[model samples]
Target: MCSLFRCSSASSLLLAFGMAVVTASPVVMSIPISAQNAVPTLLTSTSKTTFSDIKANYWARPFIQAIVERNIIDGFADGTFRPDRPVKRAEFAVMLQKAFEQKRVRQLNAGGFKDVPPNYWAASAIKEAYETGFMPGYPANLFLPKQQVGKFEAIAALANGLGLTATAPASNILNGSYTDAPIIPNYAADAVAAATQANLVVNYPNVKKLDPLEPLTRASAAALLYQALVWQERVEPLPSNLKTANYIVADVNQNNQTPNDVVTVTASDSSFSILSSLLKTAGLAVILQHPNNSMTIFAPTDEAFANLPKGTLEWLQQPENRETLIRVLTYHVVPRKRQVSELSEGKLKTFAGKAVNIQVNSLTHQTTVNNAKILQSNIQASNGIIHAINQVLIPPNINLSKK
Candidate 1:
């Protein structure tokens, strides 16, 4: 009986043990009646629980409430969520145990960790998390239960536990996604990239700054865990603009409109100087710069234009060849804006009234249109999306075989 009451909180033990002593019987009580019944009844109830400190307007309040309603996490005895508080490793392990089912890859040993004794409060949870691949212990077989978890460690744990892997190079994913990309630890880059790709990363205050080394606050943990639940199809994604639903790439356009116009923004980039000049010369600038325009432009860099055979560009600029130039330029423009995720291996109709063959490599997440390769992708603009390609796409009528 004493062993059953050993790991519970002092207040809970006093209340439960006092009742048990008064009702002591000759026969020993069962594990459910003694240990399980002695714990809090929060899980047994079906109604939603609310915390005094967690207001509806709080950024992560919805996430906290969702997890709380599912009985995955609980508030403090004082009825506070303490959203800003750093979560301990033990607390995280317990949450992970309740949140996911055990899918052990190996046999469990008699003793799991050096520090987690059998009677410790989180011992079972720690073991379950370790066996299920949600959490791993430190070097020398140590489980630092009381240690504070970091943001990257939490992301890595979720990524690994869910068996997510990066489909693209870690450097490619991280380089343009976050401002503090260099600070991400080498070992965790792939896991973080997978997390970002899955939309499991939710940053508060600033979406682009992934502070990987910062302590994992309860609010952030709830948001990330909620995203994980969404990833597993256990719950629907939150319908809030405040939630970081996608990776925030650095805004290259100087105008920085909420939904920037693609042609105007593309012209702002120095690398697209030749394309911008060609757009103006082709009398196509007005079509793209229109406020309501929506299209995808495969803009080629200056280097791509320079690679053309000598005098090829000069001939295209001639007054007699204006119609031919328009066909070539319009071939690179698609009627609708298609982000990277929307692209697939197929043929898409261009503004020139002809189709361009698009090929996508699922493994590397690389995309190509015709003979040109998409160098930089998902450059968002209000009017459309601009994908920088290595070579200019030409229409079939505009033959450059001789050149």
Candidate 2:
């Protein structure tokens, strides 16, 4: 026979010990309780799981771990988390269903999409996502389940699923935040802006370059899902500098102050105006302005441009010569930030993905990068340091034709 105790103050302790306790008077009066018909409650396992492929230093490791621990996502059968692989629409729908609860607005007699048969594994999830307003079907009632989702589509779906609306102007939010703001479609502008304000957008290598058209990767999707959970107050925010948090509000006041990046410094300096204009033409300025990236630039003065064989500079500026222009400009940029004091004679990799030899004269304390002689050394910038050179360093592969 089993016995039961009616103790008000010891209810929690009894529960932890797998026994049921009832609340009674504090005077410790024993009241008879029935144990013959009572059911026992069981405790659940709360052990943490880790993936084999994900490492501590990976950019999206935290987000991946967050989703995995919540049982919203999983690794592949081979015990690897292929973060770089693309995610399909149907797979994303299944993940969305597992991550969030939705109330069924209505019932559909048939599967919402013609492509998704009733026997399909994810048919129910797709239908629920459509009915709950998380995703919309394509034209002719066709939901391309196998199609890879793009970055913009993922952000738009998250915004719609959570019912987020933009409080500020779309143009102000997008234009002020991303360098590719003009390319964002009109229909998705507001959704993207709302996602940006909610701190959902995360870009690697360069946070400022929001390549919306690129296919959404598995790692990227995990990051977005984690941020959505944070927005919904379902998860605690993680502390990290790689999150690209609060970009719009922080950069809004940058116009008044001098920017610390090499591109902005060159643009503001009268001597480097020619180089600045060329950088903009080649679409390389955006890379130099990336908030997370650090690099060293060997800027050539206006006099160097003037010294170019007559019409050479003009020919490179033409719209048809954009690729050649990019290659030429990237040849001047080094991927790592280095000061003059750290200089040693060795081969260094440039942003162009090629190596350039650096020579130092111990007697005169002079430096030369490639074939260009340094006219000025140690110009400090926020992202990296810069040195002025007397001549433009051209890559060996580029064949510059005289116009």
Candidate 3:
């Protein structure tokens, strides 16, 4: 459906694709020109090579390391992986050259792109990408090589290049799985659906919110590329235990599970009625609905609120006490998605700028957030994760006195 390079005629010719080591999905890793420290010793995939910025608990470490081990991407000279950086179109093209090895599917006049001069550094990569049917130029033969590529563009390229097609209608597939499905560009619907079917899409924090138009980040690009490699049978999949594995999008239609945003997830479930009401009253529920946000909510159950001291809930709901209510409610939220397995005996900073002490009983395998026991854990939503607790967690230094 992509208008690039006559999708109608080219789609037929490019439909036949052969797998190889390096293909362009999105450049999940890159070596910046300033990375003079990118030596073979530092960039190799061995255990000794580590990026300073990628921590043990970082969500994308496994994918990034996997790509690094394959020599598909490299870290910076400064030892920092800079996983948050936006990947450019040219960089993605270069990565495509190194990451996939599919035989040419269709030949395009790569030289027609005026932007990529003959001596441009990425000229060959762009040409290869175009000729191989991984990435093609714009309507005007414009390959905006330096532009920041969005997730939709990246996945579309991968799906197009791999000759992936959606078995179901793109709209149905997208609407069923993603909260932000309406915003997905019409041109990318089929490719996005195909990529989703192939499990080539990896969304961290929330699995259901595609955030399709967001600029592709380095770590995210790596995850996408890794999945593509796995699809091609060119690389081993990530260990099942890794947090990164949880982010990979499975075959939703086959799985028969449609994901919803955090607020919707809470509102639909009768158990969260008390907590859901409080979030709405405190004007915090809308925040959770944002497709781009990745948060974790430690929701206290309705019974938990019932367990509160007599008149305690009533007093907190007073309009005058709204600020205190906001603080207490926000104490249950962390700005990032954290799975149950990721929680340990430590302090987790909350959205209210306070920290909650976590205690995990090793032998009993029971977890406690502050004084509240974790009644339920790892209730996933499109924009966040949710863990139900047995009691409300009041932040420190909040004045509960009614006005």
Best by TM-score: 3
lDDT of 1 by residue, 1-403 (tens): 2232233354453342221111111110001111321333333332456788888677677777777766656665556667888877887887787676635644347877888787777788788778767788888888898788999999999877765654346787776578898999998998888777666887777778889999998888888887877655467667657443432223222223333466666777899998888888877775566654456788999999999888889888887777777778878887655655456679987767688999977556578999899998766555567889999887876677564
Candidate 3 C-alpha RMSD relative to the actual structure: 21.5
Report RMSD (Å) for each prediction in the order shown: 19.1, 27.3, 21.5
Backbone clashes (count) for model 2: 0
Candidate 3: minimum summed lDDT over ten consecutive residues — where? 12-21
Is 2 or 3 the stronger prediction by TM-score? 3
- Clash-forming residue pairs, model 1: 259-382, 260-382
What's the TM-score of every candidate structure?
0.51, 0.49, 0.54
Candidate 1 residue runs with Cα over 4 Å from true position: 1-49, 240-403
lDDT of 3 by residue, 1-403 (tens): 1122122342231231111223333333464433212212334443334888999989988887777765667876568788898987878887788776655655667355888778777777788888777887888779887788999999999887765655456887888778898999998998898888768999878988889989998998889888877765457678888777889887667455444677877887788898889888877665557655567799998999898778889887888777778778878987555656457789987767689999987656678999999987766565667888999898887644432
**Per-structure clash totals for the candidates:** 2, 0, 10
Local distance difference test, per candidate? 0.70, 0.68, 0.74
Q: Is candidate 1 or candidate 3 better by TM-score?
A: 3
Q: Which one wins by lDDT: 2 or 3? A: 3
What's the true lDDT of residue 211 in model 1? 93
